[model samples]
Target: MHGKRVLLIVSGGIAAYKSLELIRLLTQAGCGVRCVLTEGGAQFVTPLSLQALSGEPVHTTLWSLTDESEMGHIALSRSADLVVVCPASADILARMAQGLASDIATTLLLATDTPVLVAPAMNVRMWQHAATRANMATLRDRGIHVVGPDDGIMACNEFGPGRLAEPPVILATIASLLAREPVPQDLAGRHALVTAGPTHEPIDPVRYIANRSSGRQGYAIAAALSARGAGVTLVSGPVSLPAPPGVALVPVETASDMLAACEAALPADIAVLAAAVGDWRVTHPGTAKLKKRPGQPAAPLSLTVNPDILASLSAPGPRRPALVIGFAAETEDLLANAADKRRRKGCDWIVANDVSLPGDGSPGVMGGDRNQVHLVTADGTEAWPSLDKREVADRLAARIAAHLAPHSLIRNSP
Candidate 1:
């Protein structure tokens, strides 16, 4: 961690006390630590303690007259390799999500383009609140990293999530980020076109056909690849997700629209078709609202097959993606179908998932915070246990990055 500077922001909560130890751990790992104490955080732990651990002056206020002489807040935050907030309370999280910069920590966050990680600490009730969950979702969409608020006993004697990650974990995460080797993408200069989410097929002007896919898994993969420093173009269907920080986004409503968009935004290094696209569309979609029939029956709506996005991407065309990945969402006999999809779609890999079981308590693939997945190669299948979807995305994107990496990149990976 030498030469790496960590800007540790301590937010108010019981967990703020841990920031001292976290600072010590970072110092011991050879990182230069700059401490920032939120007004509320200072209530639990003094600047003297944090200053002693970091061996640096503690920054407290956005408008500190002393530090303002040098534009300390901006300079301090921008110079750091990464920014971390321990005991990120629900209030702090909400403020960050809303881009509030009334204080030093949030101001530093908004001012710097560096990556941010937050380890939240709050009461079990506050942690479980719907408002908190929504805020977390929004933060994630904005490319923020979050660690534990691990589940356990809290200060109030209630048992649930919202505990701060211990110092060792934060230290390790910092080490990982510092030691992370840059991905020398063969697709580095080329464009990576990806499609994600369920396309809506209109049943009427008021309603439409769609799928239950949250698009979480696909969007996570997109974010991971974008972080690898690729020029990515995500032609997405309607989904409640933020376009990752550097990637361009094109939204489409139908399968044909997605196809047209992909073709128009083409000539790529690789393409991942993770969308759960509807197989068919209404032949004559009602432009006007279709009223419920009293005596006359509802019009019989014939359907027609939509364009096959995977097959088109794989076809030998001027705009064909060098590598194509297709997703197979199946209920039963997952492998057999995925194998067939690879053969039929002519794509390179099939990320097969089973969505039949939600809340089945099976976890991951079946409905859990984690996932269980099977990767179908031309040769065989590799199974991975249930983990957070983010982990899965990281691993898969690493694999795809490896495959698409150039000859020189393979030599450099080791």
Candidate 2:
């Protein structure tokens, strides 16, 4: 990252504090950072603090005569190799998506020709809102790089997936973006099939059984694979997440529907079964909503096993992917269970995580963003540190790239 110039746009949010650390990390790596603090951001972090850390003037207004005379907004926008919007609040993201130049930050964003990266932070509900999802999709479609709004407890005293990614993760992403060599397009011409979120098993027209999977991890993986130049098909369950950029999205509800979608996307070079598919569905689903009469006993519900999509994909068949991966979200004996699952499912690798512990005081892994996973393969287990879901996805994608390299394949059979 040496000599790389970064235009850091700090937006209003509690996460603005993290921008300080990001600046420190960038400077330490021999990169220059200049900050543009939004009005909302000033309410959280002061200009003095940012200037003290960056050792440069913090641009705060659009019409500073002296500053503009020296370094105009247009010049400032084009000065950096990349522009990063950290703590990208809902307002700023929406503005960016709409190409709104209401303020200096948005103006700079609009004027810049350099690549842009965003790290979002907002309340869980806001992050999950349809409007926000749509805005994110628009930005991604325009080729903007999104880092993270990791899942965790927010300042609002609620827990979910809207926290800003940790500083280290953001720093790493910046380094990768500023690298001299272009990002490896190793997966070019390869097809990848990925399943994400939780499959819904409908008992009736109104009621359904589903897990807590938010599909963030799976979506991140799909995005990462696409970044590596893969032709990716995302077989998603009913999740509110925006479709990842450069990927085909197949939305499904029931486990059967997901399986069918996956099969339809076959002949893929790699298959990642990340969806928390329901183990059972109603034996005979009711056509109408089930109603209860006063003083009547509750109707008994029977269940039947759903198809094992992972096992089916891993089976020895001509259409089977060259590399098959399964995810094991275990509450106890994580590594052991994951190893067992890998063998049972006949997958080449198992990404295992203990979902029993609460993340940022949240309930479990079904919806949280940070993940601590163990990579289980035939050789042994490699434990990975807890990281934002996007970071995990990026690392996993790199591993997949290395494994698929021609020289690395001599030791194994597809």
Candidate 3:
């Protein structure tokens, strides 16, 4: 990131405090940073603080005579290699999507030719609103980059995804965006099949069994592979996450549907089984919603084993992928269980992680955006430090690219 210039747009949101740390990180990385604070943003952080860290004056208004005389809005917009909106409020994002230039921030965003990255932060309801989703999709389609609004408890005493991405995540994303050359297209001509989210097994028309998997990791992996030039087929269960750009998405509800989708996507170069598939489903599901009788005990439901997707994919066959990877979300004996699973399922590698919660009441891996995983392969187990799921996905995708490179020629041969 050295010598790179970033125009940091701080928007109004509780997460605006994080922009201070973001500026510090950028400056320390030898990148020049200039901040533009919106009216809402000014409520959370002072311009002096940003100016002191950036060693440059802050741009707060569109009509500042002295500032505009020196550097006009047009010049400011084109000055940076990248423009980043940290704590991008729902309002600002909506304005950007609609090409509304009601404020200096929006005007500059419209004027800039530089690539844009936005990190959204808002209430869970607002984040999940149909309008917000549509706006974000529009931005993504337009080639803008988005980092995250990670899931967790918020200042409003609510729990769910809407928090700003941690500072480190923002920093890493900035570095990647500002790189001189395009990201390596190492997976070109390779087909990647990935399954994500928690499969729901129906017990009745209105009831089902499911797990806590949020599908963030799997979605990130799909995005990473696609970014590296792979044709990705994502067989995803019901997850709130949006479909990654440039990937084919097959949405399924039950384990059976997920398995069928994976099979249909086969002859793939690589297969990543990341879904938390249900082990058992109702043997005889009710045709309609089950009813309760006042004097009757709860009706006993018979269960049957669901199809083993990972094992099936790893089965010896000509249609088998060159590399098969599975994820083990264990709460105890993480390494041992993962190793056993790898061997038992006949997969090439297993990414294992302890999803147990600490005594301090922190979130667990089942639904969070961060993970600490152990890569168990034939040679040995490699422990990776805690990282954002996106970073982990990038690292795993790189590894997959390297592993599949040797077989690319054979696969592509006429």
Clashing pairs in 3: none
Which candidate leads in TM-score? 1
Give the TM-scores of the predictions, in the order they appear: 0.87, 0.75, 0.75
Q: Write the per-residue lDDT of candidate 3 for residues 324-386, one digit (tens) a residue.
A: 999998999999999999999999999998889562213335876468899999999999887
The better candidate by lDDT, 2 or 3, is 3
lDDT of 1 by residue, 200-319 (tens): 999888878777665666777777777776677888888888887777889999998999998887777778888888999988888898887789987788999999999989887665
Query: What TM-score does candidate 1 get on C-alpha atoms?
Result: 0.87
| Top candidate by lDDT | 3
lDDT of 2 by residue, 1-414 (tens): 888899999999999999999999999999999999999999999999999988999999999988778658889999999999998999999999989998889998998889999999999999888889778766764557888878788899999899999999999999988884666998777888999999999989999999988888889899888988888999999987778867899999999999999988877889988899999999998999999999999989999999999999999978888889999999898898999999999999999988898643232366674688899999999999887677788889989989988732221111
Q: Provide the overall lDDT of each model, using Cα atoms, as 2-decimal numbers.
A: 0.81, 0.88, 0.89
User: How much is 244 displaced in model 3, in angstroms?
Assistant: 0.7
How are the candidates ranked when ordered by lDDT, highest leading? 3, 2, 1
Worst ten in a row by lDDT for model 2:
405-414
Reference-based lDDT, residue 75, model 3: 91
